[model samples]
Target: MLLMTSIIITISTIILLKNKKSDLLDLKSEIKSISWPDKKEVNQSMLTVTLIIISASLIIWLIDSTLTFLISKII
Candidate 1:
């Protein structure tokens, strides 16, 4: 079983490398050309996202709590 699995994996890898060599190279070059964000920019974006998430969560919680309270009072 192990030998058969290894053989299958080897055949798949060979086919992939042969057929996708150009695609892989293109991807590598594209990755290299990407302008990654700097630490300050990333940090600022992260902070903004976190604040938005927290605000949304608080709003949802408030709405849920109000609904629950109203429903309980009715019951």
Candidate 2:
């Protein structure tokens, strides 16, 4: 779900950029006018979020599989 939402947002952003809808009212040039955050900060934040999600998912999967295996063995 998170991946899907990210993809959707990315695609939408791309479309908006292509159509020049993201341009500011007073900005004359697209490249110079656009305000972008620090690349390092954005990358670090994305890395942290990705790691958290992956770890949580792995933990959940492990717990689910272990329970399933134990139940099958008992039956």
Candidate 3:
């Protein structure tokens, strides 16, 4: 079942990609129209994202440990 589903998805994606020449052209045009961020802004954004991810991971670890401790005590 999983193999069949994957084959069907692959075939459909191939068909869609083959049929999307005009859409791809439009997408290329739209991408060209975009004002991309400067190097310094990109660096700052990347740093912020890294810090946020680290902070979130620490928070999740703390919560998981606290929950595990409480559940152990209750049991």
Candidate 4:
């Protein structure tokens, strides 16, 4: 599409104008210094996030249903 081509050209031109060799090299070095977590730690953290999401969804569903039921009885 024309829109996609224009966007790609704009982004590429901006990057070419702004990004320099030393800046890119510094960014790469900083990225290389990061200490990423192991597989076990990643799995444990993912499980905690999943459980929290499910718990919050169930709580919202319960509250919505209770409000709907109460409103229907009042009408």
Candidate 5:
């Protein structure tokens, strides 16, 4: 069983190495073609995300507090 597993692994490895070389080259070219964000754009995006997250958290907290107060009053 061990020998069969080793042989299967070896064959698969050889096949993958041969076939994936071209795919890797294509990926490298595609990455080079991409328009990466500049530092200013990245900072602006991060700030926007942080503001949205804080706003959502505050809204959720307000709702939770309101429900808790109403529940406490009813009890």
Candidate 6:
């Protein structure tokens, strides 16, 4: 999974950089507007990440536990 994810990210980044190379490089002033996420938005994103991590961990633990229990019973 990690290898697959890395390959996908690398490919996408390369594609993006290739596309952006055609644009004129300007270092004097900011051309694009940067909007930072508000506190509420940041908090929401953090909450989402935390929830996903916790859920995935729980699922993995449950699966391992079930397999171990089943194996012990069979033995």
- Highest TM-score among the candidates is held by which one? 5
- TM-score, one value per model: 0.71, 0.50, 0.57, 0.70, 0.74, 0.56
Q: How many backbone clashes does candidate 2 have?
A: 0
TM-score of 3: 0.57
Residue range 1-75, candidate 4, lDDT tens digits: 999999999999888867776688989999999999999999999999999999999999999999999999999
Using lDDT as the yardstick, the better of models 2 and 6 is 2
What lDDT score goes with residue 7 in model 6? 100
Best by lDDT: 5
Q: Which run of 10 residues does model 2 get worst, by summed lDDT? A: 21-30
Clashing pairs in 5: none
Q: Write the per-residue lDDT of candidate 1 for residues 1-75, one digit (tens) a residue.
A: 999999999999999998799888899999999999999999999999999999999999999999999999999
| Candidate 6: regions farther than 4 A off | 1-32
- What is the lDDT ranking, best to worst? 5, 1, 3, 4, 2, 6
Query: Could you give candidate 2's per-residue lDDT for residues 1-75 as a string of tens digits?
Result: 999999999999899887675355335565676878799989999999999999999999999999999999999
* Model 5 TM-score on a 0 to 1 scale: 0.74
Which residue pairs in candidate 3 have backbone atoms (N, alpha carbon, C) closer than 3 angstroms, thus clashing? none
Local accuracy of candidate 6 as per-residue lDDT tens digits, 1-75: 999999999999999997676554542234555568999999999999999999999999999999999999999
The lDDT per prediction is 0.97, 0.88, 0.97, 0.95, 0.98, 0.87
Clashes of each: 0, 0, 0, 0, 0, 0
The pairs that clash in candidate 6 are: none
TM-score, cand. 2 vs. native: 0.50
lDDT, model 3, position 1: 100
List runs of model 2 lying over 4 Å from the truth: 1-36
**Lowest lDDT block of 10, candidate 6:** 22-31
Q: For residue 36, what is the lDDT in candidate 3?
A: 88
